[model samples]
Target: MQQTEEHHSYARATWQVVEPYHGAVYFSPEAHARYEELGADNRAGYFASRGAALGPASAELVIGTFYNFNPDLVHRALPAAWQAASPQRFLAARLAGIDATLHRVLGPEIGSAEMLRAAELAQQAARTALRHPQGRPLFAAHAALPWPDEPHLVLWHAQSLLREFRGDGHVAALLAAGLDGIEALVTHAATGAIAAEALRTSRGWSPEQWTQAVQRLCERGWLEQGPDLALTPYGRERRQAIERTTDELADLPYAVLGQASCAELRRLARPFSLALARELLPWAVDRLAAVAD
Candidate 1:
């Protein structure tokens, strides 16, 4: 079914509002500690835990699914991370960390009726996503896991599925726009949604590789030369089109769930999202700013 503009807005809104709650594990000290216990360093912890859903996935698999990280960085982390800990162990550690992190950030709210309601609603929408997982390998992998019994954990896991479902579509959109992994990062930085240096370093792209991507974007007339990375008008339009396509692809679950239920989920999830963002997400300012624009 073709998605209406209204449904697209709901899909994007739902994603932005629920993001922090699902994303806290990435920055949670508790989660990091758990991965460390399994002999995985921070990078290994991130790659292993996120990729654990794919079993003992190869670096090529992770690199292809993850879409934007440096392939060398992926190689440095993968099979090695599996050697340090099995995918099952990595999954367990991530859940344990999420449990600890949510308890610390959300406190008494973890057991609230509101939390359960949010969890139930999010899960319903997530189930809708599960039906259409043909090309969404990451989402399909995560969906194959059993649902967590706890309300807060259920909510977190549901959002994880929904986010990855959308993310897979976003990757398709980027590819359709003819952007490679490095070019994707460069164009995103050019939009100023994130500091170029911050994104470049975090993705493990060398300064030289970053410059090359920037030059590629410039040659495509998608970027402008200056002291800093900047997107030309055409670039901005192209990026917007990519985002629109992504939102449309992601609209199915929310559209199936209907607007009112999604609104309630947003309302119930927002406080938790805000609390998690305040405590765990310093980098979210970049994302929040991008949303505002």
Candidate 2:
């Protein structure tokens, strides 16, 4: 692998380990309790609390990269929370939610200190890399937000910020290459996770909508014609290019950490990630393996 590929690989490994923990909020009891305290009742309420912290950003902005959620749900959820609180209040609530969820999931022991240390290292790297002006609007906004006091929470928020940073950049890359939200999902379906049917259900896209997106890609010569669509050479190359660009953009932070430090961070984070995966995420091990492949 090339140097950039190596850097991207390690960065992805680090992300995979921490990502499940961040996502645990969706299922965690403590997270729901925090949301209830914040006057939120359902999943939409939780999404609104966190999404509002990204500023008075439009639902279009959130829906673009948050591709899996139904747009109508996001539209409905955002205004209620956004209208009720100032950005500062929303951010505070968001942090509280993260703290509650992580504490419950990770507990007091099980390498919490090591996780904090690794998070600090990763945050430092992300901060150093973010000095440059970039098109990562969501990331830029969150990066400017204040940090939490507790080390574990700090790590969770920092990792959240970095993930948004990378995600925003990836969206930019996708658009530049002429792939829209559904189209991108169509391409992604060609590789991992199953087919367009799975994406349609998971992402709340209707069959007609998915077909339309696939048709668009077909017109562009990126996808082969027919019901069982696959990526043509052009499609494969375009997807690869998008991925490479995203990796390059996201690489700066990991590059700042360098090889040895990056490896060490992964080592420190692995056990926590594994434990969480076993307890919380049934598909996480398979997801990690797919990334490695």
- Candidate 1 stretches with Cα past 4 Å from truth are 285-293
Measured with C-alpha atoms, the lDDT of residue 155 in candidate 2 is 66
Instruction: Give all candidates' CA lDDT scores.
Output: 0.90, 0.70
Q: Write the per-residue lDDT of candidate 1 for residues 143-213, one digit (tens) a residue.
A: 89999999999999999999999999999999999999999998888777678888899999999999889
Would you estimate the TM-scores of all the predictions? Answer: 0.96, 0.86
Off by over 4 Å in 2: 1-3, 36-43, 64-70, 84-89, 110-112, 289-293
Candidate number with greatest lDDT = 1
Top model by TM-score, which number?
A: 1
Estimate the lDDT of model 1. Answer: 0.90
Estimate, for each residue in 15-131, the C-alpha lDDT of model 2 and write its tens digit.
Answer: 676676566555556556666666666565556655665676677777864655678767876666666655566566666766765666678743467976877786786676568
For model 1 the local lDDT of residue 252 reads: 92
lDDT of 1 at 247: 92
